[model samples]
Target: MPTEHDQPATHAEGTDAAPLAGKHPAPPCALVIFGAGGDLTKRLLMPALYNLSSDGLLDEGMQIVGVNHGARETSDFRDELTQSLRKFAADRASTFHTSQLNEKAWNWVVERTQYFAGEFESDDTFEGLKQLLSTIKTGNVVFYLAVTARFFKPIVEHLGRAGLLKEENGNFRRIVIEKPFGTDLASAKDLNAHILSYANEQQIYRIDHFLGKDTVQSILAVRFANALFEPMWRREYIDHVQITAAETIGVEGRGRFYEQTGAFRDMVPNHLFQLLGMIAMEPPNSFDAETVRDKKAEVFDAMKPLTAQDVVFGQYEKGPAGPGYREEPDVAPDSQTETYAAARVFIDNWRWAGVPFYLRTGKRLAARRTELSVQLKTVPFRLFRDTPVDRLTPNVLTLRIDPAHGTSFDFNVKVPGPVMEIGAVRSSFDYADFFAERANVGYETLLYDCMLGDETLFQRADSIETAWAAADPVLHPKDGPLPVHGYAAGSSGPAEADALLAADGRAWRPLVDTRKKED
Candidate 1:
């Protein structure tokens, strides 16, 4: 006899991570991965494929083709992928971590894996891919451009010229492009149009892995699914919303890339906006992919244009973490790029006309936390005005996204035998405490959804453009560069950001997560 932890993992053999019982495997398709030799392929794509295999979500007939510029034998490519997968499995620190690799599932991926070598701009690559895909059993195909931004257009065009994006015999053909869809409004529109020239909107999947967190996906369930929170979700009951995506690590060696794309454009427009859409969207009549996306798009469309007065920018100064943003390698000493940005946004709509939404993101901060907090307005009449309490404890409902996956509500409560004193207590719900864990790199569901032609989780062109439109004013402030304030790397952000909220007579919830721990 063995305890649950001692038993070997199995597919459909009654284990937590195996046999997605009611879920069916995706339709058979060939997953043609561009930039196969890159980090995204090994770090994310491979792990997602492995998880899909483990849970019996990947069709047995599915084939994987790895395309890159370098020459390598198919066996060598498979071996390298296997080694990478094993490294991720053995590392407890990794998202895809596990004590041992699933041999049967891994073997399935390796058996179906193939490799192709050709330059993205060269016609040879697309022609080679077209010929190789012809031999694959399934007519359905997914072209995933795991490469950099520069190659996005050229590769799509090459595929178009080679007739690789065509759907034949009633089989589906799709392409998944990773984001930074574009830096600003102009670039985003250009990119959208460029891609549409080669492939229709329905055939493209603009994926954002950052939105893959369980807490982010559960925003709808947290709101509409609960009667208590839905009615109080509008401008009337809520005071404001705070969206924070903070990281403790500075630009390691990507300072060169960071120099071009600042914190605001890098995050606020896409990741934060997508999360905002999820939090702010109206309840859809159905979860039909298009229906849900339309509601999300509406949120973006309603955003009031941002200006310098409503935004604050910051750059990290040297601290215990390491060198400051400018001192980092490849960064200019006089670089004006912002490492942190905070903005005051408004949705000029019926439900949330006057409500303010504060968003902030930074590379070096006191904590690495990504969460959304909804602080409700205080009661009109302070019932315990004569009590020991100076004022009511502000009611805040927090949906903690990464690092800590949970929902917590802070409200006033009576202290036991404390002479009519009121206290602030948090009633929290954690994913780990309530549900079984899964090996996820945030790419599993997006990959499966793409194979099934579900675009609800992915961004639409209109949403992307509208989100960029909201950030455009801030990105290109009419008056020279918005003054950049400096803060210690280990601090929350510049003091100016605090002023952004303080002016509204509100303050940010502390960066540190304060939750009572009970063993």
Candidate 2:
């Protein structure tokens, strides 16, 4: 049995080459993408496919069929995507090495891609799609619904009506749906039911781009691969865990969408909870999809129900230079939607009974970063209480997910002056400092995984519902308990969030203060 830990030694270009050591090469397939004319296609999906081609991971026989409502010649579609690829490269130049297009690789991808123009709900459109697939040599097919949430069911129904969902001649068929999987628990369940009606659980892939991130995946390796952290990963030894995902820029033109989906709905139930699951899940028998997902589901099931008092919501006010949430384009002046959210969550399981999981996320905040910090309980000071050294700070192990990728440990260290003084010092490991940074749009790993039938990084139906259940109280508070507070665009968040932790004699780690020092 091929384990998730298996990785192929090398990937060769030709069909005759054996599959790489641990990784099974993706079988020849056609990825039919709906809403190919949208920003997501040009910015993320296409770029990821191109990168896979450049890496020699994409199969030579694979094809990409882009579906949209407008008619365009194949050459015209290729030309437009080419320009988009150039712009994407230029935009990401400062971040990763793969920001620039590999001309040869781009050309290879262009040759294998085609465009189909048709209305998503039309029977003729899907019929035409079916006919196109018949002409290709693809042995597998992946229908990617990249359109708005509303179009998900209609497109999947059309695919089934056109008999595209059925397996043919030993070939497999899979459908990949993008996130905001559902608005809440009820809707998430409904959506899952509808999708499953058309496709089996094994054939569905729910994509959450955050899970594809390198640092996010590292959370698993840090806990399971090492014996140093797991034993101490409990309430007895850990004070609290803080997960913060802050964005410096405001909604940027997504005011309309943000109006319906606030911070709690937008980030907490999906991205943040996924992080929580990774950090809290018990070690699985293996890293395979079923085993790993089972462990993650257990984490969600063990979460204690939340109350209004356990959550705080905030809308960004005008900053020194930026507009407030209401002032943004397409936003209502009296909008009650929250752009910032902070919550204190608890797990009822034995390993984390009393440990509070502090979660926070906001747009137009003081910084653009995503990090997870594990604060260890302070050591007893009976021996050093009378010493000249001042108070000692508790140890902290932080995992930086973006804007920087790596981990750091903060601990007490003696001051070199030998005056019996104690200060906190951080030993950090940055990915870029040690390894070559490649061009990444964060979708490459996900796309590759999907092609290889790996659902370990994808969200399961149960996991989605479990997360929504935990977030229901905040989303639909009863008795007028939860209120949306206000914070300036450039500030951290509402002061009330700080008070949420303060009430427990703890404070949120300062976004600006990377380390603590004892005087």
Candidate 3:
């Protein structure tokens, strides 16, 4: 067992000759994963850490301690993780290349990884964990609670009681909390208050993996780094903003879990609202963590409270060979939980007083896609009204979040002939074309940021509460204004969703990959 004073010098302590030279490696830390044997641990968290290690971003003295209720040997844990990495590499072969996980990197990571079996609420388990942690000589610690919401409070309480949440000298303790922050506003507030009792605001990272995507983060650069777009980002020039997160598959096997967390709670408050903040927030004073988070929190605070009239819910019915939401294995036949959700949100601030922001997300939809589109108001083309051209389509700027991973702008272009016929042309920018593709599980950036103690991409407590407040009417309505509609499996969504935009004299942009089409 390595003592605190005798621990190996960290990657941060050595001369600047390693990979990413001149960049600060994370301080020596022990990452204690609460739900180590779960899918999230195998699928995302471990893969991300391996990639970071391959890139030499991890500290030399870093260690991974996985805790779970089931007892398993360290070698068994390593073998399972190895299999997961192999599967992840094959699954992401097209986008994130094969070089992400190699023999050398995998071996290096497994050597420092260990596992401990423990019940979340048991004092004996936590005491054993404390002894194991003391033997490791990690200066800083990160506690990642990847378990279900029910275990979050208990685990944190146990850690606090065990004195594992303490910060000594310059070393610190941070906790990464996975979401469904809470069911609704009041519950979310209660959860926040409880967590804050054990950790400071800066020490808590409420992660939303969507914000860690390369393109999602690029929203900032596109808005602030460029002078052309920011000037026109206001309500006067922009007609409305539409954010769509669609899925072709329903709850795979977690039907019981999905029943409690429908699309509104599952997608809207966390993932969709994170995108909303990126699109709607005012320019931050600086790019630092607190400054950026403050601006995003302000965006959530400015959102007008939603009413049942502003929202729509739907559930997918059984198609020819597909199972409906209730038909899934563990779900009840009369389940009223919504598998689809759509709403029109309004920010009360001056920059977007009248502009409506449309949000829609659903499972078993037409396509597996996530995108954000800004539709500019039509130009007052009185001069072209007399021409051969019919009504002009409004200009649109789209940020494709998944599958395509890029940005595209729709602009009118004249036909080559002398007729002056007008047609829409799409100009797109794909991330893969410009940068080298690397193995990324989306958690790489987020985990690295957490290790470096940067919370710029994470959600703040107030923001989470504010987002739930905005969606409360849709979740639990007093007047029963919104009806739960139905849509076919593999369809876009309910027709009522189209009516949501139609009522505003607008329509959703077609769900097509512009990269696959010609200009």
Predicted structure with the largest lDDT when compared to the true one: 1
lDDT tens readout by residue for model 1, 74-166 = 999999999988887778544655678888778878888988989999998888788888888778889999999999999999999999888
The parts of candidate 2 lying over 4 Å away from their true place are 1-24, 95-99, 385-390, 514-519
lDDT of 1: 0.86
- Stretches of candidate 3 off by over 4 Å are 1-18, 385-390, 513-516
lDDT per residue for candidate 3 within 1-519, as digits (tens), equals: 011322333452222335465655566789999999999998889888877777777787889999999888999998988988887887777644773556666676778899899999899988999899889877688999999999988988888889988888667788999997899998999999998888888888898888878889988988999999999999889999999999888899988898888888899989999999999999988888888989999999999888877888999988742878888988988888899999899999989999999999999987888999999988765556344323776799999988788998989887787676777788888988898777777998898888777888888898999999988876678876367798888777889999989999888876654545755
Q: TM-score of model 1 relative to the true fold? A: 0.95
Quote the lDDT for 318 in model 1. Answer: 95
Q: Local distance difference test, per candidate?
A: 0.86, 0.85, 0.84
Q: Residue 425: error of model 3 in Å?
A: 0.8
Residue 238 in candidate 1, Cα distance off native in Å:
0.5
Tens digit of per-residue lDDT, candidate 2, span 171-215: 778899998899988999999999889889878989999998889
For every model shown, what is its TM-score relative to the native structure? Answer: 0.95, 0.94, 0.94
Clashing pairs in 2: 7-22, 7-23, 8-20, 8-21, 8-22, 8-23, 9-21, 98-439
Full candidate order by lDDT, most accurate first: 1, 2, 3
lDDT accuracy of residue 223 in candidate 3: 92
